[model samples]
Target chain A: MDNSDFKGKNILIVGLGLMGCSFADAFRDLYPQKIYGFDINKEITNYAQQKGLIDEGLTKINSAILGECDFVMICLYLDDAVQFICKNMDGFKKGCIITDIVGVKRKIVSSVQEVLRDDIDYIPGHPMAGKERQGFGYADKKIFKGKNYILTPTKFNKSDNVDYLEKIIKAIGFENVVYTDPEKHDEKIAFTSQLCHVIASSMVDINVDDDISNYEGGSFQDMTRIAMINSKMWSELFIANKDKLVNVLDNFLTSIESFKMLIEKEDPKLIDKLDIIKKSRESL
Target chain B: MDNSDFKGKNILIVGLGLMGCSFADAFRDLYPQKIYGFDINKEITNYAQQKGLIDEGLTKINSAILGECDFVMICLYLDDAVQFICKNMDGFKKGCIITDIVGVKRKIVSSVQEVLRDDIDYIPGHPMAGKERQGFGYADKKIFKGKNYILTPTKFNKSDNVDYLEKIIKAIGFENVVYTDPEKHDEKIAFTSQLCHVIASSMVDINVDDDISNYEGGSFQDMTRIAMINSKMWSELFIANKDKLVNVLDNFLTSIESFKMLIEKEDPKLIDKLDIIKKSRESL
Candidate 1:
């Protein structure tokens, strides 16, 4: 339990799709004692083991397998993660530290923390990384490089456990570890992640012939690349964080409407407005 | 005049800005008789000569320089280009072919064609290439690689001159050449280029703290990269093409509003909508 290098630590990865398999691939480099993967899909489970991403694979969750792991990553959809953790609270080893890679924080963390065990620590996590295409077939450890791993630590989480999680994340190719409260994490993510996908999807849905790309420069390609989306997962995240996202959308509308008027009137002030935006964009 | 190789042609690059300097850099590889650059900024004109981007430099246009050139590329602002062409119409050598690199076609082409010299062929063009930064210092010929060059040929344009342009553009690294009428060019370019810029600028103008980028994945970065705006240039293009751009913006608002409602109601229909968007996006 005191091993900070993750040596001799048994790790469990639930829902072995992109995030789970990718995590398993990274943990192999850390030399964990065992990396066990569980998924409802037998094909993916066998595939992960065959690819050497996992040392063992489970098609179903069993207490014996779960009780041996020192850490776990619940890489399921938000509501499913809540259900999985709540239903199997007794299965995890004592003093085990678990995390999830779902994008939204408030809903999943609130639901799971409502009925979590005192003997184990669950630190809410969001790795700010993904691809437009989903599933294990597209999984690669390279996606995690230069990305951030956000940890929203609540009162129930121990300081040592949070530090250990950060250490493992850095080892797994994340460039930085960010700390925030659950509410603030959701708010920021709604703007940076969810709002961007929403805009890209809308741009594509405007229904211009795709041949219109013939006239495009790199900017249009960059702006709309994420319109190729994971529909089910993103739809769920958008709804769960609807309040913050819609508010951000409204602020965006106000800014664009002003631009509409400036263009309509051929206003000289638009130069100033765009200059301000340029400076703001550079600040990022 | 019939040589598609540009072997004996003197090419004049007007304005000596990003596009003009970059064009000069590309034309260097074609071994034109000479590349002459004209700019109000003496520093830039001298820099182009020093860098060997232009074989010769002119601080101001003249009948001596204009009369000898077999081809010209007007890289000035749309309004300035109209003025320059009108004032110098009589100076261009007979049968000299001229073109422009303006983003908006209808306004500039209409203004120039009204007073254009019949002896010289003037073709309206748009190179679907640029960078977020402007000016001669940032100019690089590599931007033209794997990009498109669009020519909106009018009845006034001679087919032979347009053919020569296609040859030159291909030699200078344009991957494709698209032909459209000036009006259709304006309409389609409004959506593909101008509207995308408007969206990126509005996203930046939303005024969130720059630190919000800490939570961003690449999607947000991609969506907002063009918000590092050439304020004066883009605001002018937006206003010049306002009617068409405003109409396109309305269509986008309608599409995004539907997304907002779907998110608000937590509608299952959102999954269907996003799937459609994903397919549409893939077409590009």
Candidate 2:
């Protein structure tokens, strides 16, 4: 499918938070079509409609209105997304392509596939773009520019639907569209995203009492910039991807322990290790 | 002990590297006088002189020429700084105010005091500013603007000398001049600066093979920006402040382990810990 095919097709976004509103804005900019949205918070849905982010905003899940959407994008927490889909599976239109923007993939993909109709195309996605802040007030259409968007499709997904979704993702301004399986997606994301948040949060958690403003340089600020995270959302993500995240966390702890031992022993090889790390970072 | 008193006074800087040339450039901009420098690398010394960062550059240390300087700033690796001061102790003019720009404080302060004359005021200092790149070629006078300059003075120093050092630090465009004891300075810096570098290096060290450039977001880039560090310099610093740094590192590991347990058990209290971390980061 192309832009002309999506011109008159109705699209539904099942959350009006930052990511959801951002997607709505980007899609509206590309296709110039009506974009409908649903959010549990009436204020957010109303605000998004008022801001012209969505053509129609529903505070409650209306099955009849939802049944008409050609595409449905779920932008809720992992468990909440699974429950929302299971509760409203019959509401979606027949042959409507379903997708999501959740951080984790394995659990969400498995649960979503178990309950979704066989006729529906449920392709899980993750957009590698976010800020330390949250809310629709901070949403921007340019968030997808030059960012990676990953699509994890199982054997159950239709190839035509996957191609249609990829075209829409590219049209929405994502620079790279990576294709992978759910297991590999979750494993890679555990190291690249979730582990970074855990490190930043833990670094900030230990220094609550110290007045670091006087001594903090760019390095400290950069390392902890993501420490101001959305607690509830991240807690859900951490629990959802626990096994992979725990493995990465163990590797990080081992690296840190090695560093500690080198310092304790005043080992001369510490310089060699640091050189290797510097070379590694330079490659990135 | 003020700006006027510093006019026409000779200043000698040891180690014509990034931090050394930055100090020279900032000081020359504030008070244009004879700024002499010494470096083991003749190319760096010559480049600094040609760029007007220093008035005179010496590839080899000359005791006769160095003895006439009114002020001296040693900006070398921690061990090198200590050795340079010890070897050139007799070369400084009588009652000349001496200082250093090394990162760690306790050992530098102790060693400088043990070898210096009673009349020379050897106050240890740390400027909370740097870049990932090294060498005098990347040095800038504006690096110190709106940054913190800390002075760790002991009872062995004169009060008038401390006031003089503070005046020079302010004149260099530093936004804040913090006065702290050596022990407290090391403790705070272990949490704020050194530990941050350790974490960044370790983070990059583990993911050497991953092609992160295609998928990295702002948080990953921010956290690993300082991973491109000077190995020899940082290794000495990490060892010099090992005890305090080890304490902070242990606390950080404990926090990470607590987060792991929360995820492993799917504990609801993870939200509380994340909230506390968010609040702490906001204060920073």
Q: Quick one: best lDDT, which candidate?
A: 1
lDDT of each: 0.88, 0.86
- Which lDDT tens digits does candidate 1 get at residues B1-284? 44546797889999999999998988888878999999988889889999999988898788988999999999988888889889999999999989999899999888988898889899999999988888899999899999988999889888888888899998889999999988888898888888889998888787566677678777778778888878888888888899999999988888888899989998999999999889888878
Among all windows of 10 consecutive residues in model 2 chain A, the one with the lowest summed lDDT is A1-10
TM-scores, one per candidate: 0.98, 0.95
Per-residue lDDT over A196-245 for candidate 1, one digit per residue giving the tens place of the 0 to 100 score: 89888988888567587688777677888898988988998999999999
Most TM-score-accurate candidate: 1
Residue ranges of candidate 2 with Cα displaced over 4 Å: A208-210, B4-6
Evaluate model 1: give its lDDT: 0.88
lDDT for residue A156 in candidate 1, whole number 0-100: 90
In candidate 1, which residue pairs get closer than 3 Å at backbone N, Cα or C atoms, i.e. clash?
Answer: none
Q: In every candidate, how many clashes are there? A: 0, 0
Best by DockQ: 1
Positional deviation of residue A210's Cα in model 2 after best superposition, in angstroms: 4.3
What is the TM-score of model 2 when looking only at chain B?
A: 0.96
Task: Looking at model 1 chain A, report the run of 10 residues with the lowest lDDT sum.
Answer: A1-10
